[model samples]
Target: MEERSNYVLRDNNDIGTVQIADDVVAMIASLAVRDIEGVEACAGNMAGELMDKVGIKNARKGAKIDIFENRVKVDVFVNIAYGYNIPVTCGKVQDKVKTTIENMTGLTVTDVNVRVVAVSMPNNK
Candidate 1:
């Protein structure tokens, strides 16, 4: 047996091994959220927000992904557009992220936790 760290091994055959990184999983979640209608933006965690202040931007800003024995858990912070139903938007985000990750990575997504950090005001100009 071999010891694995960040990446999860999806398959191993005579040719080679296929692995998916945690960062990659986070990126997938972020993208899935982006496509949802009412998502204003993906808000980063405290550390990631601090990094932004200093001119460093995290590519995968809002999504936090954890993998354990081929199972994945995701936490995504988001800003929703004003007047949109919060529960509906969050539910859409949850469903999309879970389906996308499972389809793409072949790993089971145990749960997707959505945190509504802020709501963007609709512009009337």
Candidate 2:
């Protein structure tokens, strides 16, 4: 019997393999976005919300990844802070996400689409 995993290490002489999961990639994106200055929180989509209701916490809540055709496409949903610049913040996120994923996982990130789902203002109370 042969073993199976998600990752395929692209080295012929190396005697090792790495299996990376989609959720792991999503988590990486989530962490990368958190390092930015203007992000308030990760905003999960409809399916993510439904999963939360069922007592399941998806680590890739805000980050969605599709790996195919020798590349990966990631979509991140987030709520931004009111005082920060949206375009600048998103650009930083895009760059960070792409770089971090590629550097950490050795995968090619083709597209990183950031969606600002909400704007949250600081409470005055």
Candidate 3:
């Protein structure tokens, strides 16, 4: 991967620096979270799946990435299985996201915020 120059916004002044892109971090986090057990799905918006199918290759709409001086913050919207423990599952999601993003991008993960938007019951048709 090519290194992109980073920019800092300081009191309306632009400072050039080098950092990992937010999209790359988000995608790594999202995929890592999805790999954990008890996670029914990784996305909360329709556009997310559409983008995935269309080869957009990054988390959009429902995923937010905050870049900081020494760390990164990620927020993921998810749907959980009906019988899963909400707290446990969410915690696992947070852990996996943080570990993956940090390991892959070499950036410290300060926080991982998970929003459970819905629960999906098992289909018994």
Candidate 4:
């Protein structure tokens, strides 16, 4: 009698091999925005903080990422420095997020939507 093996065969298909998770994209966007000069901080809700506690500091709650065909869309919420120009600062954040994600991840960032949730003003007497 011949002995039988219980091993299963594997498929070598490329269709399901390449992928990037939404959390990774969100983290990348968060880091990119943080690197900008005028950015005070990245805005996050309660859930975001919880994610950070689990070692996912860059995880964002309200941010959205849509991967379609060869393009990606990202939305980020941030708080800016009080004295900086809001429009200019937001533009910088948007450009950084788009360029960084596209260059690093090879994903075409079609849109970078930035929402200014708050402004941080310096304490003055």
**Candidate with the greatest lDDT versus the true structure:** 1
lDDT of 4 by residue, 1-125 (tens): 42222211223486434556666677788888777877877877654566556654343553556667657888787878788999999999888999998887777899998877778786671
Per-residue lDDT of 1-125 in model 2, one digit per residue for the tens? 32322655364556755568777888899888886899987776654575457654442378877788548889887789998999999999999999999999889999999888778889782
**Clash count for each candidate, listed in order shown:** 0, 1, 1, 0
The residue pairs that clash in candidate 4, if any, are: none
**Candidate 1 collision pairs:** none
How high a TM-score does candidate 2 get?
Answer: 0.78
lDDT score at residue 37, model 1, on the 0-100 scale: 94
Look at candidate 1 and tell me the lDDT of residue 17. 74
Rank candidates by TM-score, best first: 1, 2, 4, 3
TM-score of each: 0.81, 0.78, 0.70, 0.71
Candidate 3, 7-125: lDDT as tens digits: 23223337544455566666677678766677878764674666567654344544667777747878887778898999999999988888887677667888899977678888892
Candidate 1 Cα errors over 4 Å, as ranges? 1-5, 44-60
Span of ten consecutive residues with least summed lDDT in model 3: 2-11
lDDT of 4 at 59: 38
Model 3, position 11, has a per-residue lDDT of 36
* TM-score computed on alpha carbons, candidate 4: 0.71
Please give, for residues 24-124, the per-residue lDDT of candidate 1 as tens digits. Answer: 78888988888799998788655457645765433236787778889998988788999899999999999999999999988999999997877888888
